[model samples]
Target: MPLSPAFSSILEKEYEINFTQCLPSGRLKYTELCNLLQLTAATHADLGGISFTDMQEFNQAWVLSRMRIEIKALPQWKDIVTVKTWINTLENSRSIRALEIYLNGEKIIGGETFWAVFNTVKRRPEALALGHKHFELYPDLKATKESFSKIIINPEKEEVFEKKVILSDLDIINHVNHVKYLEWCMDVVDEKIILNQKIKSFEMNFMKELSLRDQVVIHENLSDNSIVFSITKENKNCFALQLNLV
Candidate 1:
């Protein structure tokens, strides 16, 4: 079957869920799903000529500002799945990208992300377009169902846990991997809360990067049907996350 035009300029890649990427239950882990999404995003950007290497000429690099994902089911170990991604829109400094995971031709996971180009030297966000160099490669695609705005929630004052960064948490970029932030949030959340509810959606924002020297304080609030996590290091907010469950 053919996909809709709104998902055009889409880059599709196949991946096998390896044993290492799965949990003890033989299901694909959430962190591994996040890794797949990161890889897919990079590949799509490369195909669009907006890859990290391509942006280097302009002293810029892409950074994920916010991302939201919804998982319907997780593929088991050794399952072959396809990851599809495309650019949704580009406006000034920010662009929206959507990704979906399909197993046996059935959609299982879907997500949307907001990204911005960072000026390496200035240490600030740079407009995605410089003069005529706009990233409108797939401007007509409309893959996301939600707006690209940041998620907002009020966190409780007390912290659930304080975690020290270990070497395993760092990625090639020298800072803790964005996926690790989500893992940390999950670690501090009550197991009963997780097992009792079905996670419908996830939203996270990266405010600041955390490194090996940083000690993170995690705060969590469990409402009736939602959970919010806030991470801070040295009194500065690093990440804010929300999980909606049914």
Candidate 2:
């Protein structure tokens, strides 16, 4: 697949917020916001000729490794938001992408994501199968005020709940979707905090992948200003999320 003439190093896409994508307060749900960011990134890759459809020819796909998001506000239902995305760096088996969300031309959210090329059939990380040189990289362009960080899981974290991965949790790659990890942790959060939009920023680290029917445990560590959640499988850490409150 060749790069489409419509492709640009920096891609911007507009999305209309519908009712289902919103929370009870009419603001967009966090998970839905993430979906929009990933969707925009995917669209950019598609137009650039390095998308899943192109890489799957060699059994490769992009998988998220880490993500950091800072939010000033959340858009409400019926609002039209623009998502702008670009690659900060892309080489070998890894890439760094930056994305921002705008409402009525005002920036409201910024996100930075780290992705890796994974061989689906071999089930391991690998270099991208397709060429990415057609896409220009902007190493200095950063979306978030703070870059992605290593989330430290507190050893004293309390076990919250446990569940088995279901079909709904799996994505196109036949593994648990990255966003599902956030959804799981978010479900155990205080409803008041979520509805009040007190989350100033959040970060997630995907240490390992989980498949359908995999049993996992959720753990929580609470502090004055932040909440950390870690998911473990068979006593091994699989994912971690840290939510910073306003």
- lDDT for 38 in candidate 2 is 88
Please report the candidate that would top lDDT against the real structure: 2
Model 1 lDDT per residue over 98-181, tens place: 889999999888888888877766768878643324334565554445645565647455688998999999875556878999
Q: RMSD for all candidates, in order, please.
A: 4.8, 0.6
Candidate 1, which segments miss by more than 4 Å at Cα? 1-8, 129-144, 148-150, 155-157, 191-197
Candidate 2 residue runs with Cα over 4 Å from true position: none
Give RMSD (Å) of candidate 1 vs. truth: 4.8
Scored by lDDT, model 1 comes in at 0.78
Please provide, for model 2 over 65-169, each residue's C-alpha lDDT reduced to its tens digit, 9 standing for 90 to 100: 999999999999999999999999999999999999999999999999999999999999998878888788999989999998888899999999999999999
